[model samples]
Target: MLSPSRRRRRAVGLSLAMAAMSVVVLAGCAPGGSDPGAPQRRSVNTRLADEPITIKLYTETNYTLYEELAHEFQRQHPNVTFEITKERYDVLLQNAPRLMASDNPPDLVRLDVQTDQVKDNLLLDLDPYADAYGWDRFPPTQLAPLRVSESGQRGEGSLYGYGINHSVTGVYFNKELARQIGMNEPPATMGEFEELLQAARDAGLLPIMQANAAGEANMTYQAILNQLLDRQTVEDWIYNVPGATIDVPESVAAARRLQEWAEKGYLNSDANSVDYTSMVGRFAAGEGLFMFLGNWQAAALDSEMEGNVGFFLFPPEDAGRPAIAMSTPGSLVIPAKAENPDAAAYFLNWTLTNSTARQTVADVGGSVPGGDPGRPLPDVAPGSVTEQTQEAFQDVAEGDGAIGFLTNATPGMFQNTLAPQLQLLIGGRTSPEEFAAKLQADYEEDLAS
Candidate 1:
């Protein structure tokens, strides 16, 4: 569990000016008269008040959770209804270019946190609305990725999306399995981690469940790169700084390390064909020693493994470097083409602060981005696996560490170009030098276009 002291410290560290702005917004909306029990007058300031509004939302969330939350939201605002649609992560990525070409795109869409399409102009800016509603309560670290430029623009003002919760990637291990293997604790360094993987293999068990079939599995590369490379190197490669290329020594070294892992049989043989959902199930069945996943998997683990999971920050490169993991805010953004931006914003703001909504997210095994809502999720056991998962996230957020996923933080055809190359390198079909050359060529072509 996150220490109460740490939470308070983080809350205090958030910008005082932002906090003051929030107070002003709340005060302006407070009832002008002295009837405390009376329903506060709806602000004339909102643009979507009584108009007929239907918001179309395109998302990657499970349909059941989406429907439940959508229903709860509609119950609060009887006049507002959402036309919700769902798709797999890859489908959304593949179709974004075509969808953006159409004038009638979904009013609300959940985009890949690390894609050029969304950063390029497919998404709408939310800063003006965010400022109006005092949504600045979220700290810079939590909000910056969704707010910054895809080209690595620093502090140039624009907000692309707002995430409902922040997600981090790390290692999920089975504690009982570790104990039975004669290892009593999680590995704390890169070398120890390698040893652990070897131990699992020696015990006739698959060491790691590396999901590599889809581009999504490349997230493991991103997580590992976070430890191996510096933040600026990440930014340069991702945003394609002039005169910089993806074939940089740091990137090549990272690719080579991944290939080495594969060569040593640390990764599962069936990795090339595994889907994320199936990979999670296999891990839950105790088929592997470690599973790399985002915090959102907490809910699935709770239902499938009964809160018996243990997580650790991805081990650092060496003792000198601070342990860090990939994290970004996953948000809801209303499109500029929406028929009801005002109503959509109202609904968005309401959900952001609603304790029940926050609880629903937490109960479903997702982590909330802002302050604690005081209600606990039903399935999340106190002082158990869920608590540890939350603590690990909070620690990364509070520390002065790098933020954003590598692929997400980078720009251009990074995933489409380098990710597949990484897959080939890991499968032993390509050497490290050959992988570097291909990455350089792809990056050059992207720049030419």
Candidate 2:
């Protein structure tokens, strides 16, 4: 799972915990909706202490963009430095909770909060900082993941995490392949998108370049979700609303569609065997017409493909439908034991509000800089995929179409359900009925357990 670009090197990983999540369990301590055992509510202070301080970070190994941010922050605050520990994205998924619960946890760690880890009081509640910093002005949906409640539900709860740049997923089409297939612009709808897939196949080019291995097939599942389903339905499933279920017509259609595409040979022949990095390499090297991934690849493809790749939000079912994507700011959490909670919170706030830091996040991370929507956008080359994704994020935000990753319904949900079920569905070993039903069963089992 090496990064596609040395500059970004961040994984457009499935669900990035579970995009770059660090997990803590802080249950039932919601003073202003924060963990009870967490640090006492401090007055909101944006200024860093004018004393020698070292804020430790534990994060995904490829998150060099944040490292760059830390260095720049250090330049601004000579009194502050950082000690960052890096691990593979997958390894962090398995261990962030343990790390967060450790006596000497890093101040900030990259993590996505999952339902299973919602039982402990190990993460700081960020409500005080949010009010102090005017973070309520940010897109309400974008910050939904940061809020954990007394019940440990996702959308409404204490703030547990934040991301500097919000990562957005979409389609990256090879411009030349697109033209060869007679695609003059991004497909206007999923039907047109399918036609282009057929066109690419007829032209003897791989229609889509994606890896089904490592559970990435779920990307396809989630990519088309908003097109066929309502945002509330999706939110219910992801956030653990009682009686929320995935076994529905839209979800089944989505599963069936994924299998149909696979059966039609729109994907690479080695799809099930290929890894995400391989998919990026093939799409960038011109072997495929499109790729379904996030802006995390823009910095890489912008370099490797050299403007040959074009990006579009994965199309909706038809015209006028909002094209939602699964995204949030890269999830970072403050551990309850963090030595410099205020400094960590300040740095997180700085990452969002400071134009310089936002630019660094946008430029280095190839993600939409997370901040007040009114704040002007960071500079991006005109018509670049970077620009497209940033604009797309705005559209999604304005439309309120953003949603969490389906793979993150629970910890190991992907490994236990999505990956295996998707592999089976694509392999024709499972039908849409079976696939969706299995997903519902697993979701219920995990939630109950």
At residue 425, candidate 2 shows an lDDT of 85
Extract clashing residue pairs from model 1.
114-408, 162-331, 163-330, 163-331, 164-330, 164-331, 238-410, 238-411
Which candidate gets the maximum lDDT versus the true structure? 2
Expressed as tens digits, the lDDT of each residue in 175-281 for candidate 2 is 98777767887778999999999988888888888787778878888887778988889889988899998899998899889889989998887788887777777
Alpha-carbon runs more than 4 Å astray in model 2:
1-46
State each model's CA lDDT, in order. Answer: 0.64, 0.77
Candidate 1 at residue 264, lDDT? 83
Q: For model 1, what is the alpha-carbon lDDT of residue 51?
A: 54
Q: Candidate 2, 93: how far from true, in Å?
A: 1.2
Best by TM-score: 2
